[model samples]
Target: MSPTTLTDSSRVLCPETQSPQTARPKVTTVMVKTPRVAAISLDYVLYIESAKNGPLSRRQGLSPIKWEKIVPSPRPAPMEADIVSFTWPRFQTEAILHLANQRKALQAFLFKNLVEGNLLWLAYIKDHCDYGLAVQIHGATDFLNFSNAVYNAFPARVAVKITMDNLTHLAYEEAMRAHFQHHRQIAKAIKSIRVHASVTSLTSLTVVHPDHPQQVMEVLTKDLPEWAEAIVANHPKVTTRMPPQTTNFVWVDGRKRPTTHPLDAPPSKHNTGPEFTTPRNRTAATEPCSSPSDVDDIEVIQISSGTAATSNHTKPMAPASPELESHHMETYIHVAHIHKGDKLTWARLLNHGIVHWLFFRSSSKVELIGLGFPIGIA
Candidate 1:
């Protein structure tokens, strides 16, 4: 059979038994290249200060920033009183140089602490007397140059003098060996080494020896160090002193103190257990001494096994002498309550207790014949 033919505007079709043609859509892929970005680093210093205005301002204004360099504060200088003793040079040349350095150190200290630097003094202990070098300093540079020069040092010879009022005939000879060292030129720098014990640079306070009424030394009390002042104020025999009022009245944790004094109020007790006590009392006792000959001293003894074992032989030990077998018996009874902050009082009590216990335990005259209990305070 022949196929029939059909005509259309878009395509011509033949009536043949076959599948119909379909169009496939075309696809085009696009490549997008991204630009590379580089990292940027900026170094800058920033200083901030408290702002004077509010958080935001309506008007635009230019404000200039100011920078000020920071300076560290100077530490306090060591006081002359704190220097109890130092090794003095024996040669005249070395001694003169030593005094010059001392004067410089004193001046530096005064300048650091904002103290008036008018006078310079270098004091030392020699011949069991207080002697010093006092110089009136009008200018720091001129004074330094005058003392440091080795040739014709201290042109103004009248300003320099040596004190020898307390020096004995023997002491004067010894001091000459130490200070002058057989040097005529250096001796001329010192106006005189006459008998003069007073220090004229500052007002001197006399410190008398407790045992010797004749032995006395003078010190500059106005320039005493903190530690020396503390020792003097807290001495056991001092009676006219009171507890520091400034510390007692200061606010605690930035809060106002109540109307009642803290010591006057009843303290609340905290019970930690039976190991501690509430009362504050202490007692000590010692056993009565017995004649050394009446007590028998045993050094050692062997322990025997059961009767099943064979009998063993042992050597008998001789009785020890009373001096060799000496022992002391003492009992300490302490029951007290303490707080952690009471360190000073606790230290004093502990020192007394240890001394008492040591006296009996270490004594060589006692006889060994008593039971011992531990010495302690609860």
Candidate 2:
């Protein structure tokens, strides 16, 4: 909406320049020149606001989509302390981050999100804020000129001075992780990089295994282009393996097992027996033999295996209702990794549970599956 408009058609006394009698007469039609300001759509405004926060982390009380829908858009809040809604970036970063951390990211976020344009004019309109950050960014563009003059000219890759002291020892683990993370940072530096790292533009990724530098070099040189692998030959031939990482064990049905898989699910193994030991109190007791004959048969059957074992034995609980379990199993089963939708469905705890169990198992979730004996509610 135009906050202000000038209409020459309205009969009004001019200030000191003209008295009431000298007022301009109403005309049949009046022409007014509207400044050709680049009008941004509401979508662009929200994009600018959301860009301040990092990628959608489930840090805000609401997810990215919910935050966008529920949180107020960049238009000023209706009232102070009114608490109607909050957008992701505003609520997560600007509203909560420490002043120092917030300042480091700064109003530069606004300019960074903006495309080619005169920022000053835009900032002039959004003059009020917790900080005059947006306006300051527009002011800085004249002097900083970061997008066009500074960043574009920088080299895509900087050669690391790879050395034995840095790449080979336990002390160097942090440095190596940092080195890997440094490469990750470059990918996030630009939108194109963040979406996908182009092999041509990416720096030769140096993999220096202290003891196996030669092997590391061989693999990289073979997989990567000559320009990307130039430093491989010069890298010191070393004699050390990567420091071993401390292993974490996951508890399932109460048994603890060292987990190697990304999802922490153990490889399936054959049980070859009617019953298996159950960990106490954590999961339902191991399912028993379906038939009395199977109890004596001792036939080989494949079942998921885990590491830890206990001496106690018990009968697994039979399904509360097989049809109900089947319905739940068929529905609400998410093949994908944890997503907002999966979380929403899982939180409801619908009567059907087999699908929920399958989802938890598939997702490698141990805690939220609720496999233990059901608790009675008052």
Candidate 3:
């Protein structure tokens, strides 16, 4: 399923790294995998200087290993300070605390006063006559994170449950509004991998939901697009233009809406404008027309002295249209229905203001209706 450099190198190193003879390794600890096959084991050896060398003193050849099993030592008491019941004159916690004067001193204190394990075998290195190395064993950490070095050596196998949404067909811009979509099958698999403890070298992890594709393609098979871009850059410059982006705000009542008013006649109690202001909606429309308005233009009729007008002054209103009056309930719609024969009308919407949307009647295949309002209002 996955490859590791350590495993690759171990093919050669494992054959050469045989245990030395004099160091007849007595198994102190054995960590087994499924079916109880030993995956890792630790051994210890103690030795004393002697008058003469033993038969195992020569480091040249591999004789049969003298294997022996010893009774497991008593499990050590928990390392927390236990001054609640004193064994000597001074508090045990206070005496223990004094040993933590330095890092090495603290380790020495733990090795001397705390350790109590089986000493099954003994050997002395010929070169170094007196001193011998003492080895220890550790296992996987418990729920808490206070494990020694050996315990943390293996990737902490932990399962973390997580959630994913839209496990299938996602519409355009769906994630912005979509919420948690639980896939029971996928969740069952994700619970097997611990975030920081799982094997880091594995190239991929399979998500085993029925909806998930058999294999996800994160890497492309070829780099043709990058090669194409590099070739194109060496030629003459080709000007590229991107059309303006069009966004539509459809009326709740479909295409038929109250002109210059909220779509579907929303109540005034809790109503507010759209979250983002369009260019047309944020500014006033064009100034009043000097002549009778054409079908292609909207005229602002001086209906009344809008809040600032003097009482005595009243400006003449522009001639109204029967069609426009019915739609907005006020003045005419700026720019009447565009002629179907016009060339540029099909290319773009109304040019008098910012064009945020273009209305299409695909069923009927009729002339496109262009709403030329600052904010799609009447």
Candidate 4:
């Protein structure tokens, strides 16, 4: 038999005539590749476990938060005048106007922010008081106006207050003393001193003697030739026995002398110290007191430019030590960077292990890259 004639046609038979044979569709498999780009957002969280260990794990996180915006509002206008709501009577309008005018000029001078302005304002106010202007205004108001005027005239006075406390006080006292001396010299230099007709306007020079009565008497008698002998007498000392509780001294021209008021005078001599004595309330054998010699250095600083008034005495500051200078030196740092996705992943490789195979259809195949520092290291 021939090979062509031996073929079996039974294998190519129809399904209906065959013994229940089944057929399935053909299937194919393929592989695909694509380029991926990555970028670092420049935001990072540092977990420093140890300096040597560095970052153990890093995972991508959310972006940083931004600052809120600010909106500004316009300022309100100043009130010019209120007729019905007046603080002072309209009759004193002239004086008010004068004061207002003076205030404007003073304000301009104060705006200069100079020490001299503060001194000038202080001196002017002190002179105003010396000339018996105290009765025109309340004492508290006078002090406030004097203080405010000087501060306004020279804002830089604040700096002086901060830098040199001692020098400033000394300067203030010296200025006041000089002012007193100048008035006396001017009176003598002119030879004829015009006395104001009104007793209220008279210049009353008061000399206070806390310690040496003899010295105070001599200063009044010798230095003030303008004053009479009666005007140079010592202030009468008051004892606990005396009837009057308080003493008053009257200043006539350049002299200040104590006068007695029969009704207000005490009876007789009494001890200088307090009367009552108890274990808890008893006085110390030696009272706490400061001697003039104890002071090391005196510095006069000008706090206000518009007035000559000064602050009470203050202690001097000590020099800065070497340890303080060393402590002032501190260290800091600033960092900046720009990174691409691939570079970011490469930088994060040590913290996050290498990526395995990836699939486009499934999200499980995706991996996250992290970048961070070790905790407590930086």
- Runs with alpha carbons beyond 4 Å of true place in candidate 1: 1-47, 51-355, 361-369, 373-378
Q: After superposition, how far is residue 292 of candidate 4 from its true place, in Å?
A: 75
Cα lDDT of candidate 2 equals 0.29
Residue range 71-99, candidate 4, lDDT tens digits: 11121222132211222223123222332
Best-first order by lDDT: 2, 1, 4, 3
- Model 2: CA > 4 A from native: 1-121, 124-233, 237-378
Give the Cα error of residue 91 in candidate 1, in Å. Answer: 71
State, as a TM-score between 0 and 1, how close model 3 is to the true structure.
0.13
Candidate 4 segments exceeding 4 Å error: 7-23, 31-35, 40-43, 47-378
Cα lDDT listed for each candidate: 0.29, 0.29, 0.27, 0.27
Higher-ranked by lDDT: 1 or 3? 1
lDDT of 2 by residue, 201-311 (tens): 122222333443232211211332222222222334211122122121111121212222212333232111224444454343233745665555443333354323332
Q: Which of the predicted structures, 1 or 3, would earn the higher TM-score when compared with the native?
A: 3
Cα lDDT for residue 51, candidate 3: 19
Candidate 3 structure quality by residue, lDDT tens digits, 1-378: 356545654566566678655866687966442221111211222221121223313333545223221211332222222222233223223333433333453334334433342222121222221212322212112111212211332222211111112223243245444322323322332332222112211232111112332321111113222322332343243111111112211112213323322222224311221122225534333444534444345423342313221232345344332222223211111233444564464343343321221222110121122222222222
Q: Can you give the TM-score per candidate against the true fold?
A: 0.13, 0.13, 0.13, 0.11
Top-lDDT candidate index: 2
User: How do the residues 1-378 of candidate 1 rate in per-residue lDDT, one tens digit apiece?
Assistant: 224543455353654855788998889887542232211111111111213222222223446322211111232222221111122222222323333344564323323322332223232212211122333323444334323331222121222322222224455678787655435433332212112222322333333333443443333324323213333345453211211223221112212222222123233321111121222342222224755643443122222321132122334234332322221111121212334465664464353333222232232221111111112322
